[model samples]
Target chain A: MPDTAFADPDAGLSPAELAARHGLGFAGTRPTLGGYARQLWAYRHFIVAYSNARVSASFSLTRLGRLWQVLTPLTNAAVYYLIFGVVLATRHSTPNFIAYLCTGLFIFVFTQTVAQAGVASITGNMGLIRALHFPRACLPIAIALIELQNIGASMLVLTGIVLLTGEPLTWEWLLIFPALALQMIFNTGLGMFLARLGSKMTDLKQVIPFVMRTWMYGSGVFYASSLFAEHLPRWAAVIVEANPMLVYIELIRHAMLENVKLSSTLPHLWLLAVVWALVVFVGGYVYFWRGEQEYGRG
Target chain B: MGVAEVAERPAEAGQRIPTVIVDDVHVVYRVQGPGTPGSGSPVAALSRMLTGKRTPGLREVHAIKGVSFTAYRGEAIGLIGSNGSGKSTILRAIAGLLPIEKGGLYTAGQPSLLGVNAALMNDLSGERNVELGCLAMGMSKADAKKNSPSIIEFSGINERGDFASLPMRTYSSGMAARLRFAIAAAKKHDVLLIDEALATGDARFRKRSEARVRELRAEAGTVFLVSHNNQSIIDTCERAIWLESGEIRGDGPTADVIKEYQQYMNRK
Candidate 1:
C-alpha cells in the first residue's frame, strides 16, 4: 500500500511521451524545407567568408598569388586553341575564335571546378563539419562561391580578349551577367548533388575528371556544337545540344560575339538555361537537404 | 512501461529548467577493421554486394548502451571516463554530431561540440579563423568582426608572438586548442559540450578557462566538460558522470564520482 502511494504519477508514459510532455524535440532532426532555408540564410556570411578565405589561402601560396585564378583558365584556353583551333582547324569554322574559345573555356571551367571542389567539400571539411553545427549545404555553396569569385577574375580577362579580338562592344554584352547568374545557380545545384554523392561514395571524385573531359568535348568548348550534329545522329545531336553546359556556353558566346551563329544548333537557349538552372537547383537542393543529418556522421 | 527516474537534482531543482535529456539512448558505430572477413578487399565487398549480404568486417561498436541522464540549465557537468569509454560519444550524440541508434536525445537549443581535434581551418590565420568560426556559429558579420579582437586576446595566442596572424597549422596544439575554446566560448550557448580541450592548456590558461566555464554556467547555459584531468573537473564542475565501457558507472558529485572512477581504474 505504501509502495502504491509512491508509484510514479505517469507510469504508462514512455520516455518519448515524457519528452513530448516536456516539449522537447529530438536532437539533430532535419529541419523543414523552409526552416532549412532560413538557417542557411542566417549562415550566408559564413559561406562568403569561408569561400574568400579558401580562395585567398589557396592562391597566396604560389609566387604569382591570385594571378593563378586568371592564369589557370587563360592557359587552358591557349592549350585548347592550339589543339582544337590551330591543329584541328575548328577556328576556320568559328568566327572570333579567340573570344569564342576563351568564353567557352571560362564558363565551362566555372562549372568544372565547381564540380571538382563540390565533391571534396563535405569530405575535405570533416574538421569543420564535426566541430561546428551549421548547414552542411554551406560547404557546397561555398565551393560554388569560390569558383564564382575565380570566374569573376576570369571574366575581366575575357572582356579584354573580346575587345582585343575586334568584337564590337554592344548592349548585348550585358547578357553575360544573367547567363553567369543562371550558371551559378545551376552549378550550385549540381555541386550540392555531387557533394551528397561524394560524401557517401568518395570514389566519385576520381571519376569526375574523365566525365568532365568527355562532357567538355561534347559541349563544344573549343569546337562548334554544330559539328556534333553533323557527326552524331539526330537524337544524339539533340541531346548533345541540350546539354546544360552547351546551353550556358552558347548563351555567353551569343551575348559576347556578334557573328557566331549558334541558333541553328540550339534554339531558345535562354529558356533552356532558365529551365536547367531551376531544375538542377531545386533537385540538388532537395537531395542535399534530405541528407542533412547524415553528412557529419562517420 | 515504468517511468525512469530523472537525474539527481540540485537544491534548486524546482526552479531549474532541463536543457539536455538523454532518455535510454544508444549509439553504435560501424567501423571497418581487419578482423572482419570482407574488410580488407574490394573484391570481397563487391561479392557481398552482389550476394545482398552485409560486409563481414563491418564491426558494430556499441559505444553508448542504454544511457540516460538529464542535465539542468546552468550546471557544469564533467564526464569522467577511461579511454575507450563512451564519454566522447555521449557528448557527440548530445551535440547532434553523432546519430543515436536507439532511444532519443532532446536538447533545448543547438548543442555545440568542441573537441581538442576540432580544427576550423588549419591553413587560415588564427585571426581569420576566429572571424570565420564566429560566423559559422551564427554570429552576424558585424558582431563577429567586433568580437574578434577580444576573442584573440582571450585566447592568449598573441601573448608569445603574432600567432594570430600566422596560419593555424603553425601554432602548437595547445595554442590551437586555446584559440578554439576562446572562439566557442565568446558566444553564449544553451549547451556547450567540450571534449578534452582543457587538458592541453597551461595551468594559468586552465584556470582562466575554468573560470570562463563557471561564468558560462552563471549565464544560464549548461556545460558538459569531458576531461581526463580530475582536478580540472573538480575545479570547474560540481557534478560529474563516470562512464566505463559505454555505460554510466556513477553519476553524482564530482569528488565522489571521480573517487569512484579512480578506484575502479586502479582495481582494473
Candidate 2:
C-alpha cells in the first residue's frame, strides 16, 4: 500500500479551513440572512400546506367545523354590542354602531388571535422542532397564516354587516384591502417576536390574555376612537390613537362606512399604519431570526 | 474477516470523502431546579411577580464533553453507550437539532434524524400524516403524492386493511415507529442518524430496516445508528464507537469495540 502517513496531511490547517477544503459546513452556525430568507421562501408550499391542515384540524372536533371561524367572531361581536352598544350605550356617540363595533372587534380579535397563536406556535410544536430540522420561523408564520385565514373568513360577515347597517359602498371601500394587508403584516411581525419571547419565557403565555385584554380596551375596540380623545388626557389619547389596532380599525371603518368620523388630531392614520406595519414586521422578523439557533434547546 | 485483516484495511478505502467531521464538540443542558420560588398560591405568585424576582435555580449538565469523530461516506457507524452517556445528544447535535456548547461539528449535507415520535400526528389520519410528514421534510405536494403508495407499502401498515385510512392514534407503537422509519428512510439523505428506531420493531421489521440502512450506506450516505442493542450494532455497522459517561472509551472495528465493551459491561 502507498504510504498513508504522508498522504495529504492537514496538520497545519485549522479545523474550519479543513472543513471548508472538504466541502463541509460548521454545525450550529446561523445561516446568513439572505440564505435563511431563501430557505424560508423554498418552504413556502410547506407553510401554506401546514396552515391549511391546521385550519382544517382546528375545528374538526366540532359539529360546525369551519363555520365556527366566522361564527365565533360574529358571536363575540354580538356580545360586545349587547354590553357596550345597548347596555353601556357607547353607540349613542358613534355613527353606524353595528358596522363600527363589528369592524373594531374583528380587527382587534384578528391581532389578538395572531398574538396568542404566535406565543403557542413554538411551545406547542416542540415535538416537530426536536424531531426534524426545518426553519423554526415556519411555525410562527404558519400560525399567522391560520389567523389570516380566519380573518379572511370573518371579513365576509363583516362586509355584510357594513351593508346591512345602511352604509353606502363608496370608493373608500376599496381601501379596506390595503388596510387589512398592512394589519396582516403587523400581526405577522408581532407573532414572530412573541414566538421568540414565549419560547424563552413560558410565563409570557400566561400573561398574554391579560395583556391583550388591556390592549383591546386601550385600542377602543368597543367604542369610537373619538371617545378616547374626548374622555382621556392628551398623553393617553395620543397613545390610544397611535395604537396600531386602533389605526387599523379606523382605517377599516373609514373604508367601509361613508359617514364614519375619525379623530382630526390623529394625523395621517394611513402613513402611521404603513410605518407601524414595516417597523413591527422588520423588527420582529430580525429579532426572531437572531434566536433561530436557540429554539427547541433545553 | 479476522481482527488482524480488519485492522489492516484502510477505514476510508472505498469512500475517501468524509461526510461528517465532529471535532471536539460539547453540549450542555441547563435544567431548572425545583426552587423556582413562585409556583405557590396565587397571592404569592402575584407578590413574586410584582417584586420582579423570578430567577429560578439553575443546574448545568455537561452532556457531551469534547466528543471527536470523523465519519466517511458509505460507512455505517454505531454509537454504543449506557444510559446518560450522551449518545442521543451527539446524534442530535450532528442533525443540527441541538446547539453545541463548544467545539466544531462539520457535515457535508443535511443530517436527518430518524425520530418516529415527532413526525406522525395522532389526530390526523395515517394517509394525511404521511402526506404531512413528507411535506414537513420539504417534499413537494406532487412528490409526496407519488411516494405515498410505496411509503405505505414499505411501512406494511396496509396489511391491516384500511388502517392507512384510520387515525394514527389507532396504530400500535410498533406500527407508528415503522411508519416513522418508512417516512424518514423514503427520502435519500446524505447523513442519516437513527436513534433506536429499530428497537421497537419486531425481528422481521428490524431485518428489513437493517437492509434499508445498508442500501442507504451503499448509496454513499453516512449512517449513524445509536443503540443499546450490541447485536444490532455488530450486525449492521462496520465501525463502532463506545461511549461512557460523555467520553469515548473505544473506537475501532465493530467486533473489536463490541468485545471490549461487552467485557467492560460484564465486569461491572
Which tens-of-lDDT digit does each residue in B24-44 have in candidate 2? 888998765455465555776
Query: A70, model 1: CA deviation in Å?
Result: 1.2
TM-score of every prediction relative to native: 0.92, 0.92
Model 1 clash pairs are B36-B57
Model 1, A58-81: lDDT tens per residue?
866689988898888778778877
Clashing pairs in 2: none
* Interface RMSD for all numbered candidates: 5.4, 4.8
For model 1 the local lDDT of residue B33 reads 49
User: Please, what are the lDDT tens digits per residue for candidate 2 over residues A1-298?
Assistant: 1011111455455566767878998776788888888888878877887888787677767899898988988898789888888888887787878788889889899999999989988888878898988888998999889988888888999988888988887887888899999999999999999999998887799999999999988887776778778888999888778888889988888888877678643358998899999999999989999999988676
Model 2 chain A poorest 10 in a row by lDDT? A1-10
lDDT, candidate 2, at A184: 93
